[model samples]
Target: MKALIVYGTRYASTTEIAAEIGKVLKENGFEVDIKDSRQKDIDVEPYDLIITGSGIKIGSWTKETLKFLEKNKEKLSHKKIALFAVCGATRDDEKQYQEAQEKYLDNIQEKYLTKPPVAMGLFGGVIDPNAKYGIMDKLIMKMVKKDLENKGIDTTKPYDLRDWDEIRSWAMELASK
Candidate 1:
């Protein structure tokens, strides 16, 4: 089978996850193409499976990914599509994280896109306080840091928290189908 893996990432974590998925799929004997969602255009009809992922920021998927899905809803519905979101919040609170991710999926479903995504996944994201950020992002991070500190949460360490085995398992199942 052939698969297309598309991703939208701001700090490159989601992109790394997407590439890893593609690598695992390829190792499992399926042909795969990995691309950034910002590509000028995507020809989705040629692929047997479509896997799209994005990093979640402020309880929402990236705007570029949403736009890609919105623009390709018609063509996408005819193929096997899988969705995933990378977020730091999901590491500790899966339910809340998934609910936030579902809002994006719900929007796609509401658009009347037949055959919505067959599978959805959430992966933990990376957060580096010292990393460069835009004005708004910096402000938001500062607020979040303050809140976490108030709650006695330590924010000094960087944790990956992504389960490679789980990711591989998911890809294997999708490839087997």
Candidate 2:
């Protein structure tokens, strides 16, 4: 079987996650191709499975990911599709996880996709002040970091909030299906 995993990221964390998923799919006997959503003229019709993902910044999907979906929706509707998003909300709160899923995944499915995806994943994203952000973004992240800290969550130096176990488990399940 063949699989294509395409995604967009702001600070490269989503790119890392996409690679891991592709590796798992490969291990499960799939021939996997991973691409950045910003790439041009991608033909998804050749793949048996299509997985797409994005990095969420300030409660929004990366524009490139959205554009990719818009460009490929018709072809993707006929393929086995899965969606994932990396966001900060899925970090520590169960309720926030549900809300983020509804907003980032469910609502996106309703708007851009004709059929529901085979799976939708909402995972925690990293927050790092040292990343390549504009001055305004740096200021905003400072406040966001302070707020999370005040809530008793230790915003560690790197603040890498992802759950690798959950991500790997989700991929394993997808490979099974």
The candidate that wins on lDDT is 2
Ten-residue stretch with the least lDDT total in model 2: 151-160
Write model 1 residue lDDT over 1-177, tens digit each, in one string. 899998998889888889889998899988999989888787788898889888877767777777888888889878898888787655467687667666655654555356767777777777766677899999988886777678676778654657778777877777776
How many clashes in each structure? 0, 0
> Candidate 1 local accuracy as lDDT?
0.78
Per-residue error at 3 for model 1, in Å? 0.4
- TM-score of every model versus the real structure: 0.86, 0.94
Task: Give a tens-digit lDDT track for model 2, residues 1-177.
Answer: 899999999789999999999988989999999999888888898899999999988778888889989988899889999999998876458898889999899988998899978998888878885566798898898898788789776666667888889999999999987
Which residue pairs show backbone clashes in model 2?
none
Off by over 4 Å in 2: 152-156
Taken over the whole model, the C-alpha lDDT of each candidate is 0.78, 0.88
